[model samples]
Target: MATVTESAPSQAGTEKYIPFETSVNYEKVAVGGAFENGRLESSWYKYASYLPHNVPGKQPPLEEFQHQDVGLRADPEKKALLNAPGAVFDEITPAIGTEVHNLQLSSLTSQQRDELALLAAERGVVVFKGQDFADIGKDRQREFGAHFGPLHVHQMGGQVKGYPELLPVYRDFTAGAVDNEIKNNVSSIKWHSDMSYEM
Candidate 1:
């Protein structure tokens, strides 16, 4: 359960996140739509191309999951929000990527958020420069992420304590105490893309 606080730190309106152990069975995660082989095969409705079988699966008798995806769905570049005043766009490659400068992901307007979703989907990837995103605190981070869709609570990887939506990703190099890295999926070689198994 979450508590309500009137402080500035509470970004999800008055509701503030109060973390506790969530009884999510990761193996039974495919709960968005259809079932395959007596088990759920995918989590979210894919708007783009994806191999259904490649969608990760768990065997039958799985637990329920509140599967989610981006909320700000729109035609790519439709709103032209990327062309804002003083904003600059540069391509990472001629084929598949882009980078935006002079715009902070944390302070984007609703229209800008819509356009950003389109830009990211169309470009494959879009990097926003100089974003002190992690430094903004978990409430703000969750608020920012929730704009796209309901925040996906991850199966593996460590979350920022109470904030399950905020997955703390570390580097390839070995660091942190042995006990610190002893959590599930916290091994040195984390071998998965960001939410690729979902959609």
Candidate 2:
């Protein structure tokens, strides 16, 4: 189980609260949004809404937006790709290969591995594509993952032979087919959460 550490109270009697830490690359948090424009503006009503006016003429401090901590795991390749001249999505394919080639998982320092694990925990989902894990079989994957915590067993019919963690993510291409509308035309795919309504 993951543990969250809270900040201790200050000596001056100030209540110190620790905010939630996330693993998702904080720098990429709001990647293409309206807030991209470098401006800090909010409505008067919005500011007043959060304040308590009952205390005579006392006013609350205006809430300032804090940038999310991008964490210590720096990806210079990713950064370069992001800033590359005339770089498009198609160009990113080769860049990803270069990044993967440079990533030595076993050779990572303890602090770096911890940071990665923390990132995975915070993100809830971390995806790696085109990874050649043929040498590391399903059993090895299970054994390595067991170091974290006890693994959960599949509850329904869709369980793998040996590895329960290896859940099948199937998409039936022939599900929504009409007379002429082939499998390729069907855009509606089955969307299900990994574990639904289970706490």
Top candidate when judged by TM-score against the true structure: 1
lDDT of each: 0.54, 0.37
RMSD of each: 18.7, 24.8
Q: Model 1, 67: alpha-carbon shift in Å?
A: 8.3
Candidate 2 local lDDT, residue 88: 29
Per-residue lDDT value at 77 in model 1: 41
TM-score of each: 0.52, 0.35
Tens digits of per-residue lDDT for model 1 on 1-199? 0113243443555442233322323234434545555433434323111211121343233345664434245534454465677788776555566767887787777767777776776678777767777566668878888887666766655555556566654321222343355566645443447656555
In the range 1-199, model 2's lDDT, one tens digit per residue, is 1223455544774433333322222223333422223321212122212212122232233234543333344342334423334322221121121122334343334344445454444444334333444335566556555444455554543434445454443222223223235446456233566545443
Off by over 4 Å in 2: 1-101, 104-113, 121-125, 170-191
Q: Which stretches of candidate 1 lie over 4 Å from their true place?
A: 1-80, 172-199
Report the error of model 1 at residue 182, Å.
18
Clashes of 1: 1
Residue 56 in candidate 1, Cα distance off native in Å: 22
